[model samples]
Target: MDTILIVNPKGGSGKTTLVTNLAGYLARQGEMVNLIDTDKQKSSIAWLKHRSPHLPTIFSTHTHNFANFSVKPSWSIIDTPAGLNEEILKKLLKKVDLVIVPIQPSFFDFQATQSFLEILNTKKPIRKGQTSVALVGMRVHPRTITAQQLEDFLKRQGFPIFTYIHDAQIYLQMASKGFTLFDLSPAKAKTHIEQWQPITEWIQNAHKI
Candidate 1:
């Protein structure tokens, strides 16, 4: 099974949003997707509770201690807590296939993201290529000064920015409804889901690892 870890020691950085939407996308594609919420906030669990039964199935679990991990599926999406410590991150990285750090295009979250990336780079798995890591900028407006600043910052850090999610209220609306753009009719969500194509492609290709 492939494991994807969405982590950033910064609150309101869109970690849960990334986890649920990606889970929805994978499940809709008929992949056996399981979402594990490790955050104390239990945001993913709340979203699961609101998920419509009519939609495609996505098995989920909420665990604070990170134990009793026995279920296996095509994809395992783990959402970590904000302000996570390096020791715990080290443990999580040992089992992850890919690590996705979601951040907003703002100075408010930049410090935390930079510090977290530094710690991630030091982890044995990431350094040894036992796991791959990528960055995703969420709620961004392309061509704006903020966006340009974000791009410049990432470029200096030497981290690949796989994609940028446009700043759209529809994503917030979808979360309240327990659905992702992928759950909507292709025509309705065409643009939003298209923004996620790079992420999906990376995840799909990462399955080989």
Candidate 2:
């Protein structure tokens, strides 16, 4: 299975949003996807409970029983909790093929992400190029100073910034119903889908690397 880890040391950085949406997209494409929630809040797992039977299936299991899946999955997406410790983070980093770090455009978020990225760089998988790391800007507004600053900060971190997902009520609305942009019609979610293009493409390419 291709494993993708979504992480941010700061809370409210849109980790759950990215996790569910990516799983939804893969499921829509006829891939069996598994979601692993490491957050004590269990927000991602709770979202799974709210998913309608009509939508694509995304299987999930507790963090401890990660290898106990009944159905083998093509993709596994992990939603990590905030304030993750170095030892645990290193353990999780060793097995994943990719790491996607999302940050809201702000000073505090930037500082926290910077520190986290430093830690990532020191990991064996990352230093040896066994795991790919990328960044995504969450709740960004184009042409804003903070957004531009965020882009600049991330660019300087020596990792690619796949895309910047703008602030949209649609994400919140869909999450309430256990839905993602992929579940919406093209006309209804065109812009957001466009933003996700680079992210999905990177995942596909990461498998090759």
Candidate 3:
């Protein structure tokens, strides 16, 4: 199975929101998707329980032996915690196919991501094949110069940034009701839907190591 880990060492980075919505979108596309919530906050777990029964989600606080579990889903999306714990983070990275770090367009969040990068850099060379990291710009204001500057800075720094999720009230409204962009009115949710395309494409094309 393909694994995608949504990781960020800072809170309010939209990690849970990205994971749940991405999983829901993939599931709607007929892929067997399983969501693992590693965050102690259990934000995704609460969302899963309240979500429609048709959506697939599994709550797990531990992933030491996750592969041993009887999960045969096509995709596994793991939502990690805000604090950077070496042991737990290392274990998860050792098992997943891709690591996605979601961050807001701000200096603090950008600095916070360096910690995750440092940890990944320490892993063995063999781990490189099974792991890839990308930055997702969340809650960005499209018209702001700071947003564009942040994206350009990350790209210039050799960071692989897939896409930017603009600051939209629709996302908050739908999320508050435990609904994904896939469940919202198409016309009203066009922005988020467009932003999510690249992420879905990446997951679909991920190679097995």
Candidate 4:
């Protein structure tokens, strides 16, 4: 199974949004997906509860144990807690194929992400290139100064920025319904779906270690 870890030490960085959508995308593509919620708040778990029976199946276990799954999963998406300690991050990194850090375009978020990235770079798996890391700009408005600043800031970190997801109420609406852009008709979510293409492509191409 391929594992993807969505992490950011800063809270409200859109980690849960990315996790649910990514899991939904994978499930929509007919991949067997396991959703893991490591956050104390159980946001991902709550979202799973809201998932409709007609939608593509995504499995989860309350114990957070990968071995105990309802069905064997081809993909595992882990939503991590905020302020994650180095010891736990290290352990999680060892098992993941990719790490996605989502950040809102704000000064405080940028500062917190910068510090997190510093520690992330020092992890053994990352230093050895065994696991790949990427950034995503969340809740951004296009052609705005804040968006430009986010691009500038992330570029300096020397990691790939897959795409910028704009500030849209659609995400909230979908999340509330246990859905993602991928779960909707193409006509309704074309733009957002296009924005996620790079991320999907990267997931397909990323080597599992």
Candidate 4 structure lDDT = 0.88
For model 1, the stretches where C-alpha displacement exceeds 4 angstroms are none
| TM-score ranking from best candidate downward | 1, 2, 4, 3
Best by lDDT: 2
lDDT minimum window of 10 residues, candidate 4: 63-72
Q: Give the per-residue lDDT of model 2 (tens digit) for 44-115.
A: 998888999999898896574333433247788989888888888877876688999999999999889889
C-alpha positional error of residue 140 in candidate 4 after TM-score superposition, expressed in Å: 0.6
1 or 3, greater by lDDT: 1
Better of 2 and 3 by TM-score: 2
Q: Which residue pairs in model 1 clash with each other?
A: none
Query: Would you list the rank order by lDDT, best first?
Result: 2, 1, 4, 3
Error of 1 at 25 (Å): 0.8
Candidate 3 per-residue lDDT over residues 2-107, each given as its tens digit: 8788988888899999988987787777777788877667788777767866554433343435344333577788887778587767666667778888888888
- Per-candidate local distance difference test: 0.88, 0.89, 0.75, 0.88
Residue 42 local lDDT, model 4: 91
Give a tens-digit lDDT track for model 1, residues 11-63: 88999999999999899989999999999889998998899999999899888
lDDT-superior candidate, 2 or 3 = 2
lDDT of 3: 0.75
Off by over 4 Å in 2: 64-72
Q: Tell me each candidate's TM-score.
A: 0.96, 0.95, 0.87, 0.94
Name the weakest run of 10 consecutive residues (lDDT summed) in model 3. Answer: 58-67
**How does candidate 2 fare on TM-score?**
0.95
